[model samples]
Structure formats: C-alpha cells, structure tokens
Target chain A: MTEHTVKSFDDELTHLSNTISRMGGLAEAQLAGALQALANRDSDLAVRIAASDAQVDVLEQDVQHFTVRLLALRQPVAADLRHIVAALKIASELERIADYAANVAKRSLVLNQQPAVKPVGAVINLGRLVQTILKDIMDAYVEQDVAKAIGVWNRDEEVDDLYTGLFRELITYMMEDPRTITACTHLMFMAKNIERIGDHATNIAETLHFLVVGTPLKGARPKGPSVEAQ
Target chain B: MTEHTVKSFDDELTHLSNTISRMGGLAEAQLAGALQALANRDSDLAVRIAASDAQVDVLEQDVQHFTVRLLALRQPVAADLRHIVAALKIASELERIADYAANVAKRSLVLNQQPAVKPVGAVINLGRLVQTILKDIMDAYVEQDVAKAIGVWNRDEEVDDLYTGLFRELITYMMEDPRTITACTHLMFMAKNIERIGDHATNIAETLHFLVVGTPLKGARPKGPSVEAQ
Candidate 1:
C-alpha cells in the first residue's frame, strides 16, 4: 500500500474506533438514565430512555457499515483485522447493553404505575454496579488497557452476588405480602436485566482480552453462586 | 483470482456454514433437553444440559477462528464478506441461546428439589414454543430460506404472548398459595429464559435476512405485550 492509502486506512480505523467509543458513551448514558428513572419513578424519563436505544442501534449499524467498507477497501490484515473484528463485537455488546437498559426502563414504566416495592432500592444498586462496570469496560476498550478490562471481568461475580441477594430479598418480600407479588415480580426482572447487563460487560471485557492478548481468556469465568443456586 | 484459489475459498465458506449449522443443531438439542428436563423434572438431564453448553461455546470459538482466517486470507468482498460476518453473528446468537437453555436447566434442578408447582405445565408449553422457533430459525439459516426466516421473525409475538400468559398464571398461583412462592419464582425465571431464547431466534432470523437480502430488517420488531406490561 502507498503512503497516502496507508494514511487513509489509519484514518478509517480511527473513525471506526471513535464510532464505537461514541456508542459506548451513549449506552452508558442510557443505563444511567434508566437507573435514575427507576430510582425516581420517572416514567417520562423511562419512556425517553427506552426510545433513545435507537440511537445506539444506529451507531452499531454505522460501525457495521464502516467496518465492511474498511475491510473491502483496505483488506487490512493481522492486528488491523483483529481490531476491526473486535470493534464489531464490542459494538454489538454495547448495543445489547443499551437494549437491556431500555428493557429496564420499560419495566420501570410498569413498576412506577404500581405501589413501590421495598426492593427497588436494591435493584437500582445493582443497576449502578453494572453501570460502573460498563464505564470501566469502555475505558478499557478506549485505552487498550487489559488490566482495566480484567478488572471489569473479575467484578462480574460481585454483580452476581448482589443480584443473588436481591433475588432472595425480592422473593422473601413477595412471600411476606402476596399483594406485592405483582410489583415484586417486575422488580425481580428489572434486577435480572441489570445482571444480564453485567454479563454483557464481562463479554466486552473478554473480547478486549482476546483483542489485546491474542488469546481467549483462559479457565472458567469467575462466578459467584448463581441466583438459580439460591 | 485463479480457479484453484476460487474453489478453495468456496470450500472454506462451505465449511464455515456447516460449522454454523452444526452449532445451531447443538443449540436446538440443548433447548430441547432443557424443556424435557423441566417437563419431567429430571435433574440429571438438567445437569447434563447445563454442562453441554460448553460444547456450544467451543463451537463458537471455532466459528470465530475460522471467520478470522477467511477474512485475513481471502479478503472476501460483497456476498462472501456478508456471509462470513453473518456466520459470526449467528454463531454468537446460538451460543447465547444455549446459555439461556443452560440457565433454564439450572433453574429446573432447583425447582425439582422443591415441590412441583401447578404452572409447570404452562411453562413447559412456552419452552416448547421457543424450541420450535429455534428449530425453524436454524432451518432458515441452513437452507438460506428467506421466507422461513421471516416466518421465524413473525412468530416472535406468539412466543411473547404465551410467556406473558405464563407469567400472569405463575404470579396468580403464587398470590393464591404463598407456600409456592419460591418454586413459582424459579418458574417465572424459567419462562423468562425461554422467552429470551425466542428473542435470540428472532435475532438469528434478522441476521439471515441481512445475509440473503443484503439489508437490515426494517420497521419495529413485532412484540406482544411484554410481561412487565401485565
């Protein structure tokens, strides 16, 4: 490749990375908004957060199109190929994270209509934990900091531990007051949605691990006692 | 490109597609096994199904490695590029589907230890519906049948409807008999797992549509009233 073409290719790669970074930021804001909506019982904010998911989806499509164009025009190999593929994977992960946040918002819309359950605070805490992980994983991706990614990876169990505690607490709450069954059910799902978001964050961490280290994360994923185990 | 090189590229693509088809089949079997475990309350089958998810994960890794090789070596353009990317996306979706199935299986083990709940039958039915969608979507992928894929996409609402019904029934049962709250909570999550499996099937359908039509599926995803709305 000529110097001019190589420079253009580098520019395109940078552009693709920037698109992913932008998508990550949008997803983070979406989660934060959803958590705030849940905490404040702001149905209007929840509705808007649900709708804003489309922006993340569009950015994902941009990453897809940009990557395809780069691959075809540049035929980038080795590190460039891995970088492009990782961008696609990360974008998809971020898109799903946004989707989960939207789902949480949708559930919050319903939960707000019902009487407040005691476990809402716990669910929001879980969402906040997942939100921090989302931010850290994005930073890892942007800085190519494998340690930061590993930090996010190891924190998945903390989210799970909290989710398990929340799960048991919600079930106990429901068992205590049958009237709260309907509301607690939604809280349970909201908490589960946040837990799944944590899983996706771990996924992004693993993707970054492979992208930087050029090997799959070894051994079993560090796991706490699953909610199912409880 | 020389004839020999072109032939080898076609062979590589074919191999990749076959791996995806095999992965899809394994995912289907996993869901089926999970459903059967739930239906029969067979904890042994549940344990096996959960362990078998590792196999699907390994196949996904295979798909990832193969696609990277194809992209790096072939620098495939146009249809070939889309096909390779689609395979990666589909494999990831299948892996998630298997993970959901394993989750259901894990929940089943817990539920089996508890006294059987009355709504287990309804939950099994929901799983059956999702299992069928999984099969149809896999067929759509292996046959490259757009109509079949569309069929799978359109049926997502039916799965959601059934899941919503199951959710309500389980909640009602729990409200009536507080003794069953623990068991019912497990059933609620099991149904949710199956519903998520349906969503992944729709995801596969969309991926197939894009692979064949070279365009994203347009318009809103057809969704029934979500459980949260209930």
Candidate 2:
C-alpha cells in the first residue's frame, strides 16, 4: 500500500471512532435529560427528550455506513477487524439505550399527570445510577480500559438489586392504596426501562473487553434473571 | 479467486445462515413454551424455558465468531457484506427475543405462587400474537421475502394495540381487587415482555428488508409511544 493510502485508512478509522464517540455522548445526555424531566415532572422537557432520540438514531446510521465502507475498502484484519465489529455492536447498544431513555421520558409524561406516587424518588435514584454507568462505560470504550469495563459490568448487579427493591415497594404501595395503581404501574415500567439501560451499558462493557482482549468476556454476566421474578 | 475457494466461501455463507435459522427456531420454541407455561401455570415448563435461554446465547456467540471470521477472511463487498452484517444484527435480536421469553417464564414462576389474576388470559393472547409474529419474521428471513417482511413490520401495531388494551385491563383489575395486585403486576410485565418481542420481530423484519433492498424500510414505525402513557 502507498503511504498516502495507509494514512487515509488511519484517518477513516479515526473518523469512525469519532462518530461513535459523538453518538455515545449524545445518548448519555439524552438519558440525563430524561432523568431530570422525570424528577422535575417537566412534561415539556420530557417531550423534547423523547424527540431528540432521532439524532442518536441518525448517528447510529452514520456509524453503520462508515464501518461498512471501512470494512470493504480497508479490509482490516485481526485487531482492526475486531475493533470495527465492536464499534458496530456498541453503536447498536447505544441506540437502544437512547430508546429506553425516550421510553422513560414518555412514561414520565403520563406519570406527571397523575398524583405523585410515593416511590418516584426511588425511580429517579435508579435512573441516576444507570446514567452514571452509561458515562463510565463510554469512557471505558474510548480508553479501551478492560479493568474499567469489568468494573462497569459488575455494577449491573447493583442496578438489578435496586430495581428489585423498588419493584416490591411499588407493588406494596399499590396494594395499600389501590388508587395509586395507575401512577405506580408507570413507575414500575420507568424503573424497568432504567434497568434495561444498565444492561446495555454492561453489553458495551463486554464488547469493549472483546475489542481490546480479542476474547469474549469471561464467565456469565453478573445478572441472574429478570428482576420481575422477585 | 480460484473456483474451489469460491465454492468454499459459498458453503461458509450457507453455514452461517443455517446456524441463524436454527437459532431462530430455538427462540420461537422458547417463546411458545413460555406462553404455554403461563397459560397452564406450569412452573416446571417455566423453569425449563428459562434454562433453555443459554442455548440461544451460545448460538449468538457462534454467529458473532463466524461473521467476524468471514469478514476478515473473505473481505466480502456489496450485497455479501450487507448479508453478513444483517446476520450479525439479526442474531442479536433473536438472542434478545429469547431473553424476553426467559423473563416471562421466570415471572410466571412467581405468579404461580400467588392466586391467579383475571387478566392472565389476556396476557396469553398477547404472547400468542407475538409468537406468531416471531415465526412469520423468521420465515421472511429464510425466504428473503420482502413483502412478507413488510407484513411482519406492519403487524407490530397490532401487538402494541393489544398491549395497550391489556395494560388498562390489568390495572383496572388490580384496582378492583387489590388482593390480586402481585399476580396482576407479574401479568403486566409478562404482557410487556411479549410486546417487546413483537418490537424485536419488527426490528428483524427491517433488517431483512435492508438486506434484500439495500435500504431501510421507509417512513416511521407505526408505534406512537410507550403503552404506559395510556
């Protein structure tokens, strides 16, 4: 390969990474905005948060096109091939994370109209933890830090635990005051959406682990089963 | 390229598709088993369904490894490249669909411990519809039938509509008889899990469309918002 062609290949690879990084940043901010809208009961902000998911969707498409072009043109092998594939998978994960956040925001709109349920604070707390996990996993992706990725993977259990506790609490609340069932059910799904975001973050962590180490993440994920069982 | 090498590549591609077809079959059966478990309150079948998800996970990993090797070795372009990528993405979707089925099965175990809820029949109906959608989409994938794929895509709205009605029915049932709150909540999540399976089937349908047409399915999805909003 000519030196000019090699240099151009590096530039294209970097462009693909940059597009994915930008997409990750957008997804993180979207989740943060969704959590804030839920906490403040700001229906207008929730509407905007839900609408902005389209931008993340577009970025995902950009990553897909760029990666396909890179694979076909560059024909990268070994580590480079792994990196490209990981980017593709991670972009899909981020898109779903953003979708879950939008679902949270949409549910928050309905939750806002009803009288406040007692467990709204717990829901917000769960969302905040997932938001932090998203930020940390994205950082791990950029840095290619396997240890940090493992740290993020392990912490999904904490999200699941919080979700299980909140799940029981919400059900008990509904049982005590059947009037609150409508609002509490919304809270239940909101918390479940947040829990799913944490799962996606863990998925990104595993993808990063494989990108750097060239092997699947060792052992089963820390998750046992769906929290709805508890 | 030598003719022998070309023939081997064709064989490899066929192997990849066959693996995915097997994975799809397993996922469909898993959902079928989960729905049966729910309908009969069969905890044993539910346990078996939950445990069987690991096989689907293994098949997904197989697709990932196979696709990566194909990309690095074959360096396919144009339609072949799209087919490989779509298989990777569709495998991920099938894996998630199976995970949702396992979740429904796990939740069924918990629901079985409690008294039966009135809306269990409605939840089973929703699951049956999604199960049919899953089967149809997989057929579309195997046959590469775009019209059939589009049919699967449009039918997601039916799943959403069923889920919305069931959501209200379950909530009203809980409100009317708070004693069934625990069981009804489980049914609500089971219904939501089936609804998400429909969404993933829609995703696979879109993936199949893109594989055949080299373009995304046009226009927005028929979905409006999270059913929790209603």
* iRMS values for every prediction: 3.9, 3.4
Residues A1-230, model 2: lDDT tens digits: 99999998888878878888998999998999988998899999999999999999998988987887777667788888887888888999999889888888898898888998779999999988988899999898888899999999999999999999999999899999999999998999889888989988998999899899998899988977664531
Clashing pairs in 2: none
Q: Is the docking of candidate 2 incorrect, acceptable, medium or high quality?
A: acceptable
Q: What TM-score do all the candidates reach, one by one?
A: 0.94, 0.95
Native-referenced Cα lDDT, model 2: 0.89
What tens-digit string does per-residue lDDT give for candidate 2 at B25-128?
A: 99999999999999999999999999999999999989987887787678898788888999988999999899889989999999999987778998999988
Model 1 chain B: lowest-lDDT 10 consecutive positions: B221-230
| DockQ of candidate 2 compared with the true complex | 0.49
Comparing only chain A of model 1 with the true chain A, what is the TM-score? 0.96
Candidate with the greatest lDDT versus the true structure: 2
Off by over 4 Å in 1: A224-230, B216-219, B224-230
